[model samples]
Target: MPAQIYALDISGRRTRPADPLSGHRQESWRVNLLNNNDVLLTQLVGVVGGEFTFNVNAAIRGSGSIEYSGTPLDWNQHRVQPIYRTEAGGAAVEWPLGVFLVATPSSEYKDGDRTVSLEMYDKTKILEDDLIPASYQVAKGSNVITAVRAVLALSGQTRTAFEESTQTLATAMVWPAGTSRLRIINDLLESVNYFSIWVDGDGVFRTSPYLSPADRGMSWEFEDNEKSIYSPEFTHDFDTFDVPNRVIVTGQSDGDTAAPVAVAEDNGTGPFSIATRGRVISRYEEGQEASSQATLQAIAERLLQTGQQVGSTFSIQHAPIPIDLNSVVAFRRGVEAIDVATTLQTISYSMDTGALCSTTLREFIQ
Candidate 1:
């Protein structure tokens, strides 16, 4: 593996020097890419960001710990962007991990040298720290994109600056009274069929369809024994704890309390004794336009089917490539011959040896 180039930019500025940071006096860096499905503090995290850890020799900035002594590095900054690239066949290809907010920087003495480890997070961290304005609100009958833009604009962000799907909300989102921006985004996501939100390496906010890939492009195959470099950790289970067997949707418009309602139920769960299990009900309140009985029933049925096929997650380490979440991919096990087209869920990347990526995937249903 030839040496990979790396550069550290301040305040999300793009740095393109003749000689990159890899040619400078740094050891290496590791990046952990996370998406909405990834959990943090027991909560679902979103708008894809990453934890970047890098080690640098003290000779570059003098050997001193900021926690103990004065240091030359600026700890307070808007963003720290890390750009990396590999040289192959005399040509170089670059991959810029998203700009991150420097969280912590620690220094230690190892052998005869002092090394520093800088930990950073993506810009989405701002969302956690900042609160949505109390007076902010989305108008009735506004589309999902419009609502998202309104939410983002609270923090001086624009939806036009991010990658997003053209899909709109089935009904207008209700932002009754005061609501956090995070809550508003999650609610909008729930109303859409397969959409998700994430931030990209370019610092662009993205609201795109995931877990439902319209295009199944490319595939990665692994066979047990000698055919593959590694095997994936796969598991499947059924727990009735929060599993719903029935769903009810009620359509109610303002000043019209006599709207119709719809319900969907599942009567078969094999011979596992349906009598022993109680029905779990999910209730959805209609906003904006009153939903028809057929629409409500369809929504219930879709949820039921999705719950039934929750599917397995596949985690594997393979060559690195920028794969977006919810994109369709093919996975095959040797001798099985059955090809599984699935959704790319979460991604983790490491560059100690070479450009390698570990990704988690959820099976996509037809």
Candidate 2:
């Protein structure tokens, strides 16, 4: 098997052929990237970025640590961009994973060996910053796509980072105090069924509708044989806390009379079942017109109907390219079971250890 390529470029620390001692190393380096629950190996557009730890052996130390000479891996002054490449045509080709944010570095000495571990985060950290509360409101009657753009603009993200949104939203929205931009945008997207958002391979933040498995045009077949490279795990959940049998939608503010109320119920529950499994109250969201009771009822019906279904999650290994967040995927569970369709929800990759690639998918009930 060919060796995986790992390279690093520090913004403040530059290296060249002329300098006798430059710390930049885009060639041979011993570094291992770590993954956590917060982020996955697959680079999805809206998902939080996984963390990486770079382990540098002391034997490669040229002029001691960055604390003394500040040659390489500067903790305070430099920003790191991790570059990934693969072999093709007997030469290395640029296979960019994504940009990384380097945290502080720590060192340890054991058995006459010195190693340094540098923590790093993906681009999702850009949304973690708190936004100024003054710039949080979107005007009424604005396009949903435009509302998202306005939020990103106030969050310090550049216009170049945005991609065209496939869905349109035409609701008035408000931003609460002390809220992060990520939280607000995610809420708005979900309200309109625009559940797909993530940074692409090219580092652009994209927004789109929830893609069904058919939209992606990819099918994965798993056989129960020893020669097969695929393994699958499934989870079925029915949480009453997340489901609501009755949904009450409250319309926009009116004068003296009570505000319009629209209610929806599921008649399918068993007689002995809990009279009310849950109750959801939707207020002037989901493009519901304030003055229209009919629009409020439509919103209530959508909420109640989506809340009454059995949900499932499927995870499998060796997922192919383009099998990313919100990609609708078809699954074949051998001859014994019928084919099922699900949406790709999460992905993880590991090239150093077993070259494993895995994906988790869920049935989009709504």
Candidate 3:
């Protein structure tokens, strides 16, 4: 069994009396629908799910759809939890795939049957819809985190798990009326070098400081061993044509004087570095509003770190693990002499009963 689907029964026998859980497969998948306030609405039954996809580049980073053979119910901005049991039997534990919100819902009738499909996205969707009503600015001497928390209040998204950054704003960041809250939040995160942003399994807006894959080693492993959850087929790919070796961010002055330019370059002996590559693969951008040189430098470094060259990504399948883009796992496909660490860049899961997962991982070449 892949997903090994199950339902939530807080009381009574979950499985058979004697056979509490499967010896080999542990437990099944469980899902729950919740209201906007996160109160239990109902446990979804007889529902089949489409692919639940989460990618780092997407604005609405996480999305999925679920279909059931019944008329649609009132469910816009409603939440859902895709759950699974970690162990077998009464001693088993439950973990959620993610806490997602219903984005759009549709209903159709055919052959005397009514089918309803709900399209869901993560909590970040709310920020996308919210707009700043007046001129907004995080003053030069203010704390960006406080400003971020206040902006999140615009959409009533207070459940946040953020690393308290001590980055004092060196320059006032300004946005006009009608600016997107998501963009503002993203910019604020970038200024503090805290770029990893996502709504976690419990629908909390989670943030963490940016770090190289080389600095992190933990969690899970994928090997060529026959018993491993990873499928036999392994894929290795390189996107080297567009690899960037330098990032230059120019500041556009809000008033009279423009801020100085800031640039980040791969200066070391790595294959993608400017010295080794010979030819400079440069990416340039102008800030929306002028910022101090320190701020511009931070932005330049952020852009460079996120867009690295020699892009080697691998495609693999693994048992549904409580992992996200922030996760870094070790990998070894010994047959082709391929042994390298991997950082997940794209993840997609088939959320149907007994379904599995697929991910594209960035080859961490330190």
For all candidates in order, the CA lDDT equals 0.46, 0.44, 0.71
Model 1 segments beyond 4 Å from truth? 1-72, 83-92, 109-116, 133-135, 159-179, 192-194, 209-211, 214-247, 250-255, 258-306, 335-338
Query: Which has the better TM-score: candidate 1, or candidate 2?
Result: 1
Q: Please give, for residues 61-129, the per-residue lDDT of candidate 2 as tens digits.
A: 111111111223444443333333332222333333444445666765669555555454444456655
A best-first ranking of the candidates according to their lDDT comes to: 3, 1, 2
RMSD of candidate 1 to the truth, in angstroms, is 11.0
lDDT of 1 by residue, 1-366 (tens): 012233325443434433321221222342333333221212111212223321111111101111212233454633444444543332334555564555466666758555455555555555545555455544444566666777777766663443354545434445544555756665565454324445555556665433324354544434344434344444333344555556666654435456556666666653211343654445354541322345445556655545543444566665454344445666766554545656665655544445446666555445
Cα error, residue 236 of model 3, in Å, equals 2.2
Pick by lDDT: 1 or 2, better one: 1
Question: Clashes in each model (backbone N, CA, C under 3 Å)?
Answer: 2, 8, 4
Which pairs, if any, clash in model 1?
47-198, 47-199
Candidate 3 segments exceeding 4 Å error: 1-27, 70-72, 86-93, 251-258, 288-299
Residue clash pairs of candidate 2: 45-198, 45-199, 46-197, 46-198, 144-169, 212-328, 213-328, 213-329
What is the TM-score (0 to 1) of candidate 3? 0.84
Clashes of 1: 2
* C-alpha-based local distance difference test score of model 3: 0.71
Candidate 3 Cα deviation (angstroms), residue 358: 1.3
lDDT of 3 by residue, 1-366 (tens): 012234335563354323223334554666787888777778877575556888877987898887766435666646888776645454554556678877556777889887777788888888988888998888876777887888898788899888887666767888899988999988887766676467877777877777666666555577677556677786888877778889988775546666568889999887788898898999998753333466677768767766772388888876666567756777787777877777777778775555567888877556
